[model samples]
Target: TKMLRHGEVHGKPLTSKQKGLFGLLAGGGKPTRLKKKRDRRLESR
Candidate 1:
């Protein structure tokens, strides 16, 4: 419940690994492999 109730409450983004760990502890399911998507908008010149 901490994940859902307090994870994002700080206005910070949580990494995939953190999400997976939280999910597991919360009895939601297995840890999911998160894919890294390239953000074109953030690409450096």
Candidate 2:
């Protein structure tokens, strides 16, 4: 369900890297700096 929802929102399937990041997040790791920066850019847009 998570993968399906992610695909629906992004309009494409997740790549291995993206899936790995999602796994990291699900496992309670802090968001990486790059991910935080990207999220900031998206929010600014």
Candidate 3:
């Protein structure tokens, strides 16, 4: 994974929680409720 590779390069491996936060900050966390709302809207169409 890019995050793991990044950690390796930086010499600081991130924990699962930290990876989750990184994903959130990068706007790649589709687990957010906003993603669900967008999915619902698409389905309604």
Candidate 4:
């Protein structure tokens, strides 16, 4: 029977390009940018 392994289907692995497309299709696409944390001391500057 075919199985999934490490983000792969059957015995074939997903390529970098396909991974991105699949991620979006699976609704797990990465955010465009991460939110940066601001230090409390920096807020006063």
Candidate 5:
């Protein structure tokens, strides 16, 4: 909706939210090492 408005009328590409979400996905979204780090910490304790 907003992207359509931007390109059709406002002339921008996309919103910041869309860009951020894309970036997050491209970068693998969540912290991939979370469980590994937790296990390592538990082992050290």
Candidate 6:
């Protein structure tokens, strides 16, 4: 929902946050980077 709305507005990708959050919840795997989240946020802007 967030990514869809963001993609509609910004015409850019908006998925890393969702992916990172999902990865956190899922647990036990490779870690996600904060830089990725920051980059995605900047792109959303």
Best by TM-score: 2
Relative to the true structure, candidate 1 reaches a TM of 0.43
Pairs of residues at least 3 apart in sequence or in different chains that clash in candidate 4? none
TM-score of each: 0.43, 0.46, 0.40, 0.41, 0.37, 0.30
Off by over 4 Å in 3: 1-5, 8-10, 28-45
Per-residue lDDT tens digits for candidate 6, residues 6-26, read 443356564777656655645
Report backbone clashes per prediction: 0, 0, 0, 0, 0, 0
Estimate the overall C-alpha local distance difference test score of candidate 4: 0.55
State which candidate has the highest lDDT: 2
lDDT of 2 at 42: 98
> 1-45 in candidate 4: lDDT tens per residue?
122237677767878766766565467655343223345446779
- Writing each residue's lDDT as its tens digit, candidate 3 over 1-36 gives 587448643677688777776677677555676678
Better of 3 and 6 by TM-score: 3
The better-scoring model by TM-score among 1 and 4 is: 1
Identify the runs in model 6 with alpha carbons over 4 angstroms from their true place: 1-14, 28-45
- Name the runs in model 5 displaced over 4 angstroms: 1-12, 30-45
lDDT of each: 0.61, 0.73, 0.71, 0.55, 0.60, 0.60
Judged by TM-score relative to the true structure, which candidate is superior, 5 or 6? 5
Clashing pairs in 3: none
**Model 5, range 1-45, lDDT digits (tens) per residue?**
443334433555666766655556666776446668988999997
Question: How big is the positional error of residue 18 in model 2, measured in Å on the Cα after superposition?
Answer: 0.2
How do these models rank on TM-score, best leading?
A: 2, 1, 4, 3, 5, 6
